[model samples]
Target: MAFKIGVYGSNIVESERALGLARELGQALAAHGCIVITGACSGMPYAVAKTAFEHGAEVWGFTPALNLDEHRRAYPQDDIGIYRRLIYVPPSYHDLFGLTPATAEQDWGARLKYRNVISTVNSDAGIIISGGWGTLNEFTNLIYEGKPIGILIGSGGLADELPVWYPRLRKKTASPVLFEGNPTRLLSLILQRLE
Candidate 1:
């Protein structure tokens, strides 16, 4: 089976530069014969998934909703056209009521974090695009789990900040988290590490 690469980032607060970079990354990963995995939300994930699909890569989404109706309600303006497979993770009672930070054992952000966990679990490596709290959460999860990651620097948001914080992180990974602003080179480096 093709290796799955998880694409995690912001659902909102996207810039043209970030979206374009995401497309390039997707295309590169697809060209390398890797399947793209995502949370199936909007912004960077959608942008990446679209280009990956166009490049003939199989895209998979781990959605938080149980069915189509719930998905539509959760992401009314988003598109799921690029996903070759959609895995639904039903919302738990905690997801509906809990308001704490996401942990490895529990659902957070109304099961959105749970979907992030599922995405990471299914992928061999991950690419972090411009994002906010959700992206940070996913990045932390990947690092804690010892999964290799690529952070797209210069894309704004968390991607730009990771390089600064990475050096200070007390917990380290032997598999380095590669950071590059240039999309082509970044993709090449990520594939090199993974392959």
Candidate 2:
């Protein structure tokens, strides 16, 4: 089976450099014979998935909705069609699994957490680029699971902040966590560890 690489990042990266880096990373991941995985959201992750798919790499996703309509409502800004396969984890699953509530006003936050867990659990490793709260949540999950993660610095947000904070956390594990600002080098490093 091809190694799966989870790309976790913001759904709203506007800077040209950051966007370009995400695409480059996607292309590199595909070129290296690795399957791409994402939260199935928009922006950076979408860019990565699109490039990776165009390069003939399988792109799997963990969607937040149970069906197409729900998916559209949940993530109207996202390009859901980019994913080759998406494992749907609905809001009710959280309540069924004792993670959240299944009320009319559903616990979307809890659902998102469950989705992130599912995404990281199925992947061999992860790459964190410029991101927000969601990306940080994914990174923390990966770290706790002792999964390898490559953080792309200079992309801003949590990706740049992690290098400064990871050491302060004083967490230790056998899993490899690498930080690099250069997209090419970061891709190479991640692929090396996976192989």
Candidate 3:
């Protein structure tokens, strides 16, 4: 089977450099025969999704949506320029076997957390571009869990110097989390690790 790479990032961007990096990272993953996995949202993740699809790579969207319609309506999946398929599951934490809902906000977060874990756990590795608090949480989860991860550095957002400041990343993450300046080379390395 092809290697699966869970892509972590946000649709929101802080600058042009960040967006450029995200696109390169996505293209690299697809070029190396690694399946691109995302939260099925937008921004960096979406950019990667498009590249993977365009390159004929198998793209999977592990969305937080309950169904296909919701994914299309609420997410940036209208045109599958890069992705091949979309899989929607409840993002609620209640789906975690035994969990009780506390409040409306908690319920919503649970759903996102639920899907995030599912996507990351199932992947052989991950790619973290620029992002915010949510991206950090996903990256941290994957690292502490001992998954091999790669970062497309210089993209700002989650890149440009992410691990330096985040102690948790240095502590739990198995460095050096493969950093690459070229997408193709980075993806090739990831594929080698997967094999």
Lowest-sum lDDT 10-residue window in model 3: 167-176
Q: Over the stretch 1-195, how does candidate 1's per-residue lDDT look in tens digits? A: 688889888887478888789888878888888899989888888888889899999999888777778778778887677778988875453555565645733543557767877888888888889888988888988887787889998788899998888889998665569999987787778777776
Ranking by lDDT: 2, 1, 3
Off by over 4 Å in 2: 90-92, 99-106
> For residues 1-195, what per-residue lDDT tens digits would candidate 3 score against the true structure?
788888887666656877776677766766677788988787788777777777777888877777777667776444644456676675444655687768956755776777788889877888777777778778877877788777767666776567576544337445337787666677777767767
Prediction 2 global C-alpha lDDT? 0.84
TM-score of each: 0.87, 0.91, 0.83
Candidate closest to the true structure, highest lDDT: 2
Alpha-carbon local distance difference test for all models: 0.82, 0.84, 0.73
Candidate 1's C-alpha lDDT?
0.82
- lDDT, candidate 3, residue 75? 63
For residues 1-195, could you state the per-residue lDDT of candidate 2 as single tens digits?
689999999988747888888889888888887889988888788888888888888999888777778878877876666688988886468557765366745666666778899999998899998998999899988988888899998887888888878888877775688999887798888778877
Clashing pairs in 1: none
